[model samples]
Target: MPRILLIDDDEQLGPPLAAYFQRFELALTQALRPSEGLALLAQGGFDAAILDVMLPEMDGFELCRTLRKTSDIPVLMLTARGDVMDRVVGLELGADDYLPKPFEPRELVARVQTVLRRRRTAAPAELDPDEWRFEGGLSIAPTRRRVLREGTEVELTGTEFELLLLLAREPGRVFNRDDILNQLRGHEAELYTRAVDIVVSRLRKKLEPLDAIKTLRNAGYALALRRLP
Candidate 1:
């Protein structure tokens, strides 16, 4: 069973949700405060984390920033419905995904399953050459799920890493918004096109100086780097 840490202060939300998750073999652990949640996270044994943006002391984005500094545990943020900025900022802060509040429990479960699946299969057992080297000193090792620039490791979330891998695998192939969304989520989200752009922008920022990603206005994005021999 996968253990999920949910850091939200809603006194009424956790219990019933936990019960519902159990039906899918998911164990949900709730923390009423960010400090408590961080403590639990540090102790480990969590498959993923679900954070609520509106918290008492510290917000979810700050917590996510702090968590990414040490752990790459998949994060699924819960934000207020129609809070576009919250969702975008969460993704930029290294959250694997986000689900707006006022959502169905079934939708939440689907999102959790998607993120967990990505985490479990983010890396493959073999690459034709084990490592992919690109111009401007960027390298990716799919088997290890590691990225490097000028010999230095670049930490990336599972979603970011997968996005990079997808584009890098087919350099110059323009992946439109729908294609990118479908590739990442295993389905298309017509209303979440901005989500795709946010993720791409975040990935590009991490690959700075190399400029490994190129954006095409009104179209989509593609890998800007060329394979190195």
Candidate 2:
């Protein structure tokens, strides 16, 4: 059974969501306070978490940063504010996905199932030697869960790292938005093509001085291994 910890201050929303998840094999736990949520997380061993942006004593973003320090447990952040900045910030903070408030219960369930499925399928595994390296100074160490550019370590969140590795694995191949989403495979939340673009943009900035990726016009992105003169 997959365990999910939901941290939200919305007294009305939590129980209903919990009840809904009960219908499935998922064991849903709710924490109304950030402190309590962090404590439960520290106790360990949850398959994933659903967090709300607003909370008493430490908001969801802070809690997410803290969690990423020690664990790679998948996180989905919820907020009433539907600002693009908030969603992007949450993604950059290591959240697997973000859901705005006023969402349908069925949508929430879909997102949860998607996240859990991705988690199960994306368990770290050994990478093929060919899939692990980029000629222009990029390399993925799957065993270490690290990315190196010009032999220097580049900090990447779990999602960002996975996106980079997936692109790098098949150099020069243009992956459409749906293809990338399917490749990511398991987060039932609404898939935004913009999210993929944002992740790729961030990776490009991080891989500066060694151009390892190129955006193909109207086609998606490709890993360019050949060095530019």
Candidate 3:
């Protein structure tokens, strides 16, 4: 069973949610405050995290940003109002997925499973070379899903790595927003178009000085670097 951490101030939320998650073979651990959650995460047994937007000690967005500085654990955020801007900010802050308040337990479980799936899927067999090198001293190891810039390891969130590989695989091929969303989260494409841009921006920042990606006015993005021989 994959271990999952839930950080929420609502004392009533964890027990029932944990019980429900067991039905899907996920072990749920609870933390009532951001500090507690951060401490628990520092201990490092969790496979993923579920954060409620209305958290104590710190809001989920700040917590997510702080977490990203040191770890790339997949994160799913819960928005109290199901607001679009809230979801967008969560994505921008490195959350792997988001859910609205008053959501169905089943839907939440499905979203959790989807993010986990995205976390594990490497890439298409044929394109997954042991490692790929680009012209600007950037290299990607498909098996480890790791990236290096000028031989220096560049830590990336799961979503960021996935988006990077997606563009790197095709080199110059342009991928529109819907195509990326469908690849990232098949069910969220229509509602989360801006998500692709968010991931692209995040990925670009992390792989700085390489100029690894290019965007055509309304056409979309592509890998700007050529493969190393």
Candidate 4:
């Protein structure tokens, strides 16, 4: 069973949700305080983490930032419904995905499963090369699940790496927001198009000097880099 940690201050939220998650064969552990959650995470053995943005003691964003300094464990953030900035900030903080409050447990489970899938598989296709080399010293090794920029290793979260891999597989192939959200999240979300833009912005920053991703006016985004000869 995959273990999951949920960091939320809602004292009444854990037991019932834990029971629900158990039905899916996922072991859910709840931490009512950020300090407690950080302690539990420090002990290790969690496959993923679900954080509530409104938590006490430095909030979920700070916890995520601190945790990211040491681990790449998949993260799903719970944001306030209708707060676009909340979702955007979570993604900006390296959250693998986000779900709004008042969400169905079933939907949350589905999102968690999608995040796990992303962590497991990132390459575009089975027949693609083990490593993809692009122009301007960018290379992605799918087998190793690593990216290198100009010969130096670049650290990317699972979501970021997966998006990059998707675009690199077919350089210049336009991937509209809906398509990207589907490919990456496994569900259609009308509000998540901005999520795509936020991720692209992050990728652009990390891939500086190369201008590796191009935005097509109202069409979509594509890998601007070409394969290395």
Could you estimate the TM-score for every candidate? 0.90, 0.74, 0.96, 0.89
lDDT-better candidate, 1 vs 3: 3
Q: Global lDDT of each model?
A: 0.88, 0.75, 0.88, 0.86
- Deviation from native of the Cα of residue 87 in model 1, angstroms: 1.8
Cα deviation of 100, candidate 2, in Å: 1.7
> Model 2: per-residue lDDT, tens digit, 28-134?
89999988988999999788899998888888889888887777788889966557777878877778877888788788778888776654444244444423666
Model 4: per-residue Cα lDDT over 1-229, one tens digit each? 9899999999889999999999999999999988998899999999899999998888999998988888778999999888878877888888998888989999999889888778777454663677789889998898678889999987777788888888887898999998788777654365577778878888888898888999999999999988865
Query: What would the per-residue lDDT of candidate 1 be over residues 1-229, giving only the tens digit for each residue?
Result: 9999999999899999999999999999999999999999999999999999999789999999999999888999999888778877898898988888898999898999998887667444444467999989999988677899999999888899889988988888999988888879654253468778888888888888887888899999999889887
Candidate 2 runs further than 4 Å off: 122-158, 176-178, 181-193, 204-211, 217-219, 226-229
In Å, residue 211's CA in model 1 sits off its true spot by: 1.5
How many pairs of residues in model 3 come into backbone collision? 0
List, residue by residue over 1-229, the lDDT tens digit for candidate 3: 8899999998998999999999999999999999999999999989899999998788999999999999999999999664888889999999988888988989988988987887788778888889999998999998787899999999988888888888888899999877788778666544566888888998999899989899988888999999886
Ten residues in sequence with the least summed lDDT for candidate 4: 121-130
Worst 10 residues of 3 by lDDT: 184-193
Q: What RMSD does model 4 have?
A: 2.1
For candidate 3, what is the TM-score?
0.96
